[model samples]
Target: MRTFLDSFFILCLCFTTARSLECTRCTDYSGEGCSQTTSACPANTNTCVFTYSELRIANQVVPLTTKTCGNDNECNQISRMTLAEDTSFLRSSTCCNSDNCTSPTPILPVLDTTPNGFSCPACYLINSTSCQSTGTIACRGDETRCIRMSINGGATFSLAFQGCSSANICSMQQYFNGLNSQLNYGVACCDPSSQGSNTCTV
Candidate 1:
């Protein structure tokens, strides 16, 4: 009986060790290398994921990249959509499942700053009753609507982003999940009568 119990314990330990996966976690956008220590994934975590996004707000454009644990569904899922002249667009996600199987950082393409004449109310403020902006920006391409995205995940931690949006983003039908949070997005498209009105106040 003692021998059998010891064998059972050893088997369980071996199983757990076999399931452990190590993945690199890091974030960078300025063409810098993202190097970090490997982390042991939780037992339930399935895959390691890397994502890159380019966001254009007002006159400023920025990039965001991250590495995190993701599900099997996100594996090899590459999604990219430009919001009217690429105002703010989600780039892609590359997911791998093997231990320490993370790929290299993605290289971002060059920026296209050409104005597409799509304009909307653009403000990214927090806990404020109104959006404050001196002027509206030109929408690039296929982005003909004003959009507002509100994220509420943590208690008292809410963010608001109101800007130009493409039809692809405004009529988005799916809600995607990210590290520790599920993004619930809502969009209000600019009516034809509201275009170039400085504010989609309708």
Candidate 2:
């Protein structure tokens, strides 16, 4: 009886160890490479992910990069949104499956400026959950859908943005939310001509 109990415990320990995965974790805001440290991923995560994002508002551009553990579903995903002629957001991610595997920095997708004959209400604001559209904006490239994305960065910081986006941005909302536990997001999508409040509901 004693031998059987010990064997059962050993088997459970080995199974846990086999299911564990390690990944690199880091963040950078200068577009330069980040200093990475190995971290054991949570039981629900399975891949090492590297992501890069660029936000352009007016004439200023901000770039951010991060490496962390994620799931395989988020691998090689890209999302883009254009709120106005001077404001846009782009993000891309790459993923790998080995412990401490080095992933190349994700490349932002090329900007498509050609008009696609669609228009939508546009707004952007920080530290606010609701925003009133300044005006409608013309949609370009593959931005045939309207999107409203609200990001809660912390107790005191929130962002509201409504604009035109590619369909992938709406489909990948879950993956985006999983990228950072410190942030919460609400993403909705609709056709450009849709009417009513629930029009944006995905």
Q: Go through the candidates in order and give each one's C-alpha lDDT.
A: 0.50, 0.70
TM-score of each prediction: 0.51, 0.78
Runs in model 1 deviating more than 4 A are 1-22, 28-31, 37-47, 53-64, 71-93, 128-136, 141-145, 153-156, 166-178, 181-202
Report the C-alpha lDDT of model 1 over 95-136, residue by residue, as the tens digit. 778877866555555544455565665665544323565556
Where does candidate 2 have its weakest 10-residue lDDT segment?
Answer: 7-16
Judged by whole-model lDDT over C-alpha atoms, candidate 1 comes out at 0.50
In model 2, where do residues sit more than 4 Å from their true spots?
A: 1-19, 153-155, 179-182, 192-202
Steric clash pairs (candidate 1): 84-143, 85-140, 85-141, 118-139
User: Candidate 1 vs. truth: CA RMSD?
Assistant: 13.1
Give the C-alpha miss distance for residue 98 in model 2, angstroms. Answer: 0.5
lDDT of 2 by residue, 57-160 (tens): 78887777777777787679777789888988777889888988987779987888888777778887777766888677878878878888777766746777
